[model samples]
Target chain A: MNRLFVFCEGPDDIRFFEGVLKSELREGYASVELIAYAGMKHIRVDGFIRGIGAMGDDYLMVADIDSDRTVKAKKNRLKRWYRELDTDKVIIVIKEIEGWYLAGLNDHASRSLGLRPLPGTDRITKERFNRMIPDHYVSRIDLMIEIIKRYSIKVAREKNRSFRFFYWKCLE
Target chain B: MRIKQVSCRNFKSFSDLTVDLDEYNILIGTNAAGKTNFIRIFRFFRDIARHGLGNAISLQGGAEYIRNIRISSDVPTEIGIIFENELGVFSGVRDTRGGSHTLSFHQIEYRFSLQIEEGGYRILEDFLRISCSCTPDLGEGESGQGELRITHTEDGVFYELSTPEGIAIEITEIIPPYLQKNVPRSGTLLIENPLLVPMPGFQRFFAEIAIYDFDPRTPRKAIPLSGRSDLEEDGSNLAIVLKGILADPEKKRRLSNLMTELLPFVQDIDVRKFMDSSIYFTVTERYGDEHPLPSSVISDGTVNVINLICALYFDEKPFIVIEEPEKNVHPYLIARVVSMFGDAARNKQILITTHNPGVVRHADIEDILLISRDSAGYSIITKPARREEVRTFLKNEVGIEELYIQNLLGL
Candidate 1:
């Protein structure tokens, strides 16, 4: 199995990709060893990317839209960002990671929290979504992991175009 | 007596993190990244010196918390520290432990591997040895820093003594009797023994080391206490220490003068007789113009600063491990404290763990040990100056603190 370094935003992103995503991706592909490169260090991203590239491990990444909605717009605006960071594959979560979590929220999980099922295509507002979470300190990724397990990948893909493309890329 | 390097195995968050020590060290990391645990490694030794091994292990949640959960080893947890003896050369290498010497300084290395059993943790191998330096204590016996070696066995149960003229092994005769008499507060038996007095190289080095942590609440309690030169973990002796310093006209004046620099108050520090014969103080305002501040009523920051200043001045503990000097003080005040520690480190080796950016920014890059948790949830430590990229950045910049404020310290 190849040693794949999956670069994500934070510990939460790492937990989602490594703990949940990899657990579901174990059908045929080699397990990925996730490395969370918090883009907070914006100036040193290129240096860190270059350092990881020199490590010989294939780099896969996921970045949040943070502000921009389109990937091309983000790339155009963040021209100074290390665009060549991804060696194998890369994807962006629209608006923020909450949209991906909302896309994967099933009825049972939504009802468990006294909430109705969210439309697969709907963009999640951080304020509205965080209202359902009673404990703020608990890992939002772990909570999403439980909800995503029962989520229809087909429905999530249909609602979230970016997540859908990323999901297909994972199988590929 | 400077700690050149330390390598720890199976310590919390660190499977193996070895880094060289600097005069002024700032151990910085995100919350729960085990910066405190890394500092505990030094505290563990201090506890052993103050209390025993059993008490030290129990204080930090026992051996289970100490052993790195990643390793399932049948062997014991290991920690090795190396320093240069007075006559040993600074090899700055792990392997050269009193083996080969080119300088007058004798290299000394102490390794302790503790194994936890049903009852308590057992110290496996802990011994101190110096590079061949013959002290003239052997009756005007031709002492010219010659090939006189004081080596201890791997079990720490024996000493392998060798001189340029002779060689002697003390497994049964001298070693057993001395160790039997020792109370075992530390891993090694080198505190203050007549046998060790013959060669003061290793003995003096270990004795000068001291660790302290002052609790702010201690100064608030009205307790009567006597002062000593060495300050306790909590500033329980705040009033007593003040009283002791106040007794000495020169030292008392110096304390008030230094306080003026750190804290601006036109008042004096007074210690009065409290209620009982315990650690408490009574703050009263009886004077007309000059309101003398008692230790109990002093602000938390003022008390902490006073304890720190007293520790630096009176306590001659060459190797001092202070937890967080940045506590209870303004950031600007903390910056002054950091510089004071920097000066203190010049005379005595000081290791500090802090969340203060003032310390990180003001301290030299070589002194910063940036600690971070890896993907496996283990802590890794690195000196920013040791890295070429960070060194390149520092070459162009005036402010290193901005590296941290900009969230670039993880490098």
Candidate 2:
């Protein structure tokens, strides 16, 4: 049986994805086990599979790409990283949540995308963007998901188009 | 195959010490007592000799100059690991504050001495002497500036040559097969101190020795719930390693069988990339249903176990080193896990460091390393006598936890 594994950086990512995306993955991943890892180093799921069980070709790693340094440097590092990758078994998602939040569409972005801000948030914000522009239209989470899907196809070469961005809940 | 002897000086907590290793060795020491440092010497020698001087020094916490000598004494510290090699006997020595020397088989010994000068420590004197077990000879009138004289000897004939000039002198040459590769590089001057010197010959020998630390830091995310080997440091290549294993059906079934033994609840693993290009590991249960065991849902213990099993079972041939194997694991499972390692380590040499008595009690005492510190500031690594001391202590009023806490076996 082929299993799909998901590793989220934090607990909130786990709860939000499992709670919201359950319906979409339910049938497609009938024999799949979904788990959320809190940190990068805490899990050795690949090593576990090597000895007794096998790891499926499908894997997803999610992390927040907050701040300018994270957005530019991390993505660049990940871009160069693709050269060494097999490109057929894994997908990496870098969320520019902070980029979306600071662009004047803070509350609507949060509510529409289901993104939970770091610790001190009381509730989803109702703030709205006063000015709409082409700059704002580009680089949204929805567009990011689409780009990731296309990028994955170039690398993984999987024929199935059923794959969805692990952080797709942000687009809801 | 076995460690014949270990001599240490001014290394960490040990000021000076020499200990022999028997078939069954025990190293007993108190907490903060340099026992770990004693075990670390093997790693130090293995790493330095295997990886080269640069890597060894870097791995041992690089500090530019490793002036590791006796704290209060003027005596330069030295450590020599004497072991039996296939050709014959060899002793690799490192003087933390002195020089690097090697005693090889063909009755030839190379010694490079260090002199602390204003610029930096320089090689004041170097010698390539011969010692044919029955006799020793220190060559006479050998004076040269910035040149390493290598003498290859064979059948009582010595052929000596200088580095840059390549001037050959007729001393006597018994050039064994190993000495053929002794080519000197002239442009860069090799450092005098052992810390900066490279041992090409020792490295050749050390490659046969394998050491696996099984560090929990081997990025857990790299382990696909269903995969073969692990990824590189950042676990970025996990996808590649997984795909390599999944391409074959026989190997996948082998993985399934092993998983059944370790994680009974794990029926199977399903891996896939969503249309978005993100990869995920989904686990199937014994029941028909399955779900993804998000990298987060798994516990640390499960991750560590999986890492160990993967490295042990997946690699071609391996030598394993484990630290605190009992961490995050249930006490009841310690015996079972140890037994599994014991069985797996049947053909491999295994070195483990642990504070868990459960781990110790479960294994044969012969494999236990009883490390402890003595009053002289030297770490004394000795096995517990066959006497009833350790056994009686285990059966006595104190439990394993208290025994360690009360400083019974030191550390």
Residue B41, candidate 1: Cα error in Å is: 1.6
Q: For each candidate, what's the DockQ? A: 0.01, 0.01
lDDT per residue (tens digit) for residues A24-60 in model 2: 4455554434444321122243443342234443444
What Cα-based lDDT does every candidate model obtain? 0.62, 0.42
Which ten contiguous residues of candidate 1 chain B have the minimum total lDDT?
Answer: B92-101
For candidate 2, state the interface root-mean-square deviation in angstroms to 1 decimal. 19.9
Taking candidate 1, what TM-score does its chain B reach relative to the real chain B? 0.78
Model 1 regions lying over 4 Å from their true place? A1-172, B85-105, B117-123, B134-156, B162-209, B226-229, B275-288, B395-398
User: How well is each residue in B1-411 modelled by candidate 1, as lDDT tens digits?
Assistant: 678888888887788879888776778877888888787777776665555566667888987787876677565788877775364332211111222222244666666677755555666756565554444332343433433233333333345544445323232322346553334334443333325423334555554566667898776676645456457767666766666778887576566545554664435666677555654433333352555655556678877887887776656676777777778887645545665675456457788877777677656677788888888888888776777767666666534677776656666
Query: Can you give the lDDT of residue A172 in candidate 2?
Result: 23
